[model samples]
Target: MKQKLIFFIAIAICFSSCENKEKNQSVILKGSIQNSNDSVLIFYYSDKSDTVFLSGKNDFRFVLDLKMPVYGYFRINKKTINVFLSPGDSLELKADANRLEEITFSGIGADENKCLSQLSEERTKQEINYEEWFSLDEKQFVFKSDSAYKAQLIFLENLQHKFNNLNPFFTKTEKARIFYTYAESRIAYERSQVFSANSKQKLSPAFYSFQKEINLNDSTMVFIPEYQIFLKTYLDKKVYEQEKNYETMNDLIGAEFDIILSEIKQQQIKNYLLHSVFRDHLQFNGLEGAKDLLALYEKHTTNKKNKDEISSLVKKWQQLLPGNSAPEIALQDELGKIHSLKDFKGKYVFIDFWATWCYPCRREIPHLAKLHKEYSGKNIVFISISIDKQKEAWEQMLKIEKMPWLQLHTTPDAKLLQDYQIYSIPRFVLIDKEGKIVNAQAPAPSEKKLRDMLDMAL
Candidate 1:
């Protein structure tokens, strides 16, 4: 009986100790912003976000329950500052909205936060002359890049020496950031060389020796932005090297998705890369040829959250499939007259979702005009809808271009944009005479395919 009683007491004590440990792990972040225009502050930690409303005095507080150390950011108005937080950290931050770079920190986690702020300032200085750096020859770039990385490492090391109690996670993640940032710059050199000079200069094998140092499947560094960027650059280089005679860019894109799915062994890293690929594919290429990649993604990815999100996105795009009733959007013409797809129900509609700021949309105007003239008195109509937030800019563009066809305007946040899944500008949609979608993602006017499609429709 005494042994049983002692066992129960021991179990109770263990539970109590665990509960206290968890409570101590909670992070208390309180901050104040001076001369701020925004009422709310956002803290982004990995994939999670916490929004806190600022008080009348422009002060805010966030109590984050965390099991481990994390690198996060505090977004104040248009500017964001880096923050490194650990379990039991109680940090106080102060900044002026106009001068976020001069942010100050205090309290338990103050040293690390201050270090991150200083490091960010140094990174900005390094990138300030990026175009000049990118213009350097391979040898010059390597020398410059190596020197910059060495300086960054020395700077971080000096800070670590200054702050003796800095968390090991912060130091480790900072080192990873420095390493990946250098790696990304090295990988990007080839692209810059190719695009800037339009020359396919053969790079020596020694140029890419940095690639040997990379662990492509580092799941621990997945949340670090620099590491994410390096992985993307590395994958892009790999795809470029492996490119063969392909029928279309879509074929290359499809192969790229397959490469990410097959080559990346780390589950979290795979999830991030796959999610990015799908989102980019959907935005630029639309739903065409996305199914195979989606199926592969579903098979490979074990993240339920990412899987659910991708599934939701796929469902949204599915609504824009051919033969579906065209999404009804209320638009206004130059004179503020309302119009809908129903107004042109008996005419084949070639809709242009564009903005005045879109250069591609401007380039397509001549081709669109020619098509309108050729199809005059035919059973089709060309409609250009401006998604420019500034109504005056849309009106000014219509007047200057003197486009003969129908001109209309809608806000960027219009439900029509959402329904059409219009994330990019210069998006073209084709509707049959009966108001059913012929193609939600139609070929651009500049393409021969568009003329062929129109001829077939007519």
Candidate 2:
């Protein structure tokens, strides 16, 4: 009797274990790539990244624990596959490695993914060229933008209804995704119309109705790319609308803070915008009148982590203040000539860290040329280092532009990056003739103060 009872207990325990295992099974994302064998593949979303090696037949697979629906990036070398993912999805794909964009999906969420694919195809075919868009009248522009947004909204509504039974949460997130995109279209339409209108043809009241619908404090949408962009657009518009209220730049910054604190109710969103504004102000203008802003952030924000992170950045910026020895950089010139920061020791170096793809960086090139010409015989050197991954493209651009300053290229990830904490590009660093950093975070070539600083350095 004792042995039989022990056997029954063992079976019950085994059954319980099996049930738990079945319940814990994750969302599976597996696929195979045809043509060209690449050893490594990468999958990324938001702040998370995962890397895996390919099989002999270019087959790849990923098992993920997903709590909510989101977009993810699947990459094979330089090629990328954008995908929509959700729980209980056993997603499968067979794609051509050379044409990563063209893919077919199968399994649980196959139908929804197909809809996304259709939209992607539509976007590629329907996107208006920049010059073509600018040529359109305000009415035409508004119609085009509105139509695009409306069509996407209709599609999203139908999709949500179809998938509502599967997961209401998933459908809601999908709606948010589409809504994020709609925000971009809305902003673009209004901006184009506003730019063309004369003083008497004031429009904002007509085209900006959608702005009132958005919840400024919704941090839940932070993970969406379009949502992040929308926040930037919204905040920028707020600054422009209230520009007349503030007289000086410092006053403007203070007003921006007040607006954010008053309008944004979520701690996370406030913390993000506060940290962003503070960091950017520090980056461009240095620490002048910024201590007050930092104190304001500390007083208003309740997020400990965000406060700590900004505090750390504040300390780092302090270290990068004027008169500090510039971080050492080693790079090669266009003709396979190796050089170091020390090579330009005798002359004042107007060090510009830029990339070919950056529009602001390209815009500053003309200013740099003008400055170089003006100070041609002076004791200064204008050196631009490109952080471009493609050497051929960089060379082509330089040849096409005929830049009059020293041009050099470095790999995308370099030691120079770590030493300088250079987060954004088109950054200018003014190093003294004695090889010491005069302004570690110097003004841009286009800034009027840049010339004054350079004159003082010389």
Query: Per-candidate TM vs. native?
Result: 0.91, 0.75
Per-residue CA lDDT of candidate 1, range 1-458, in tens? 99999999999999999988998799999989998888888899977889999999999999999888888887667677788888999999999989887788999999998899888888888762568888777888888999999999999999999889888888988998999998888878787886775545677899878878889898779889999888888888878777576676567667777788778988889889988776677666776766777787788778888788777778878888898888886778898799888988899999999999999999999999988999999999889999999999988888799999999888998888889989998999999999999999899999999999999989
Total clashes, candidate 2? 0
> Which prediction has the highest lDDT against the true structure?
1
Question: Taking the candidates one at a time, how many backbone clashes does each contain?
Answer: 0, 0
Candidate 1 regions exceeding 4 Å error are 1-16, 34-40, 128-130, 194-201, 248-250
Give the candidate number with the greatest TM-score: 1
lDDT of 2 by residue, 274-312 (tens): 777776776555565688888897898776766777777
RMSD of 2: 5.1
Determine the C-alpha RMSD for candidate 1 after optimal superposition of all C-alphas: 2.7
Candidate 2 has an lDDT of 0.75
C-alpha positional error of residue 391 in candidate 2 after TM-score superposition, expressed in Å: 4.7
In model 1, what lDDT does residue 276 have?
A: 76
